[model samples]
Target: MRKPVLTIFYQFNPWSTTIGGIQTLINIFIKYAPPEFAVRLVGTANDKTQPILKWQSAEFAGKEISFLPLFSLKNDNVRSLIPTTVKYTAALLGQCFESDFMHFHRLEPTLAALNWQGEKTLFIHNDIHTQMQTVRDKKAILWRRFPAAYFAVESLLVPQFSQILSCNTDAVKHYKERYKSVSDRVAYIKNSYDNELFYPLNQEEKEVEKRELAQKLGLPDDTRFVLFAGRLHPQKDPTLLVRAIAALNDPCVHLLIAGDGELAAQVRTEIDTSGLTGRVTMLGAVPIAQLAQLHRICNVFVLSSAYEGLPLVVLEALASGTPVVTTECGETPKLLTSNSGIVCRQRTSECIADALRKVLQHPEDYPIESCVETAQPYAARTVVRDIYSEMLNRWEQRVTFAVKV
Candidate 1:
């Protein structure tokens, strides 16, 4: 039998300068796609003047990854906003017409692009309802200025996909409840870590990286660090992480934030107002290779996100044998069992501070090995296989339904 041809439509591909959850997903997907699966990536071309469609093959763990580019022309203003949805939607519709199956990552465009006639799956990584609510409450510039046409499109097509896979169970349940027609289509596929790239460093390497990072970030030799490595967005709740560290009142406890976003100015204001000039360091954007080193040097990984589907960084941090202190976002309890790490109440500076304190006060007592093992099941191969198996089932169902029709 001929293997199915799968084309992935993601607006935000991994080639972007800074890393985020979407980038991590693509990296893992490339690593895990089998030889029999003729996988092709269809993303908005990164550079202008590039061909609308381009293809290439690269070896990942000795398996070849066939990549294709689908360019979407955009006005910078509209592109930064949501009309890019229209762009990607058209691009995906074209691909769906061409490929045997189409898999998508982002929610907005995916919702708009899903076709019931095609073998389609939407990969959701966060609660869009919650994210939309936050944006409405904040009246963010992006929300206020963008076209409302996309929202209308999302309302109609979000439930039409052949399958909907959220990164965590909470998101899956929420989407299922909200869209009963597609309840059976909604499922959970947890995020995975790249064990090969993110792992505990040996003593010599750890010592050298720690010393170098300290020197580069202007930290003292004795300073123990708690690191946050994602976009500095309002939803990511970086200010809360800063407030937590300030509440600690521990001069030796340094907070390292390693990403940039629209909320950069707000985070800078908070850092200045809190008088955490030297204590809180913002390494605007670091390369992926350097980020792994930063994870190794840090004693604890921290997140205070208002919401998450399932953060890949948490798993990455754990695989690196770094203890964690995370807000009670999606699947926080699932990630933090009895002996893993501290999970705090949501959006509270005091609660975050308390959790950080517990990890900092007695770091040796926390089972770092258990934290590492907890992430073993969600390794890249396991996650990709889960996605592949689910796609196969969905494809077969599509065929059966078509035969009946």
Candidate 2:
């Protein structure tokens, strides 16, 4: 029999700026996906481009992963006027109509799945319920100032989908409580990382990579940097880390900030106001390969995000054998055992400062072996195989029902 066709609905353009955790997840899925299913990744073009129907990626071992352009509709004139997101949503919906199974990876595609009658699965990266609640507190649509309309629309649609692939226990609980009808269908699969690219570097290897990176980044050899890599936005709480660093008052310690967003000005302002100008360097938006190197070299990886589904940077840090100091977000506590890293008791600067100090003081406590072992379960092959297994079983049940009739 022919392999089951699974059309994945998501957006990503390596040629564009959206290469965050979602893109990383897609890369892993492409890499470790089993051969039992024929995969078609139906992603939207960031810019106006013709549709892309490509062959399998040899690097990823993916089968016929195609990029469907959102703007290229059957009606050219009307397609031009279709709003980009709407066009993207339409493209995903179009693919769902023909595929054996549908896998949605973002909120827009999830909303689009409302119209798709198939054995569909949801892959949520953000806490939608928390976001909607935030909108309520701010009394703004965040979409406009907050979106009363988006909340209403998502409220109507999300509960109807049976199978949801949750990244953490908290997400699974949220889905179960909110949608009791589909509670049994919510499955917990932790996020994954590229084991080949990011792994524990030996002491000799670490020293070399650190020195090379420092030279490339124009830093002194003595700098013991704490790395914070994520968008500098309210949700990510980069300011919290900056505050903690300033409070530490250690001359040997320095802060290195990567990635940029709306809170860039605020972060710079915090650095200047705290008199940490010379110590904090904003290395805005390094390449992913460079990011892996940074993770390998840094004394500690800090994630002060207010929330996350499961921050990919955290996984990458653990995989790179770097100890982490972080607020409890997503699967962080689940991922970090006592032997691996430190999880702060509170979100305040003082609490974070104390945690960082403890980690910095005890280099002997967190072995490279423990960190790598913690990350082993989250390897791309292991997690991706489980997702495929769950999806394949569901598809088989659907096939059985079809055959019965």
Clashes of each: 0, 7
Clashes of 1: 0
Query: What range of 10 consecutive residues in model 2 has the weakest lDDT sum?
Result: 72-81
User: TM per model?
Assistant: 0.84, 0.84
lDDT string for model 1 (1-405, tens) is 567788777665445554578767776777777665777776655666546666766454456666656664332211244455556766656444346777777655564444435577788887665555554225332443444653675567776677788878767888888788878988877788877888887546666877777777777877888899988766687888888888888998889888887677888899999999989888876777777777877888899887777888888888887888888777756777656688886568888888888887887666557777877888887777877886677667766897899
- Residue by residue across 1-405, what tens digits does model 2's lDDT show? 678877666555533444368777877777677878776666544444444543233223334454454443332111133344565765556443456777777556566566666677778776656645553124212443546677576568777566787786777888788777778888787889988778878977887877776676667776677999876656777888889998888877878898876668889999999999978889876777778888888888888766777888888998999888888766787679897888887888988899888887887798788888888888887778887897789788878898999
Query: What's the lDDT for candidate 2?
Result: 0.72
How big is the RMSD of model 1? 4.0
Off by over 4 Å in 2: 15-17, 46-64, 71-98, 134-151, 400-404
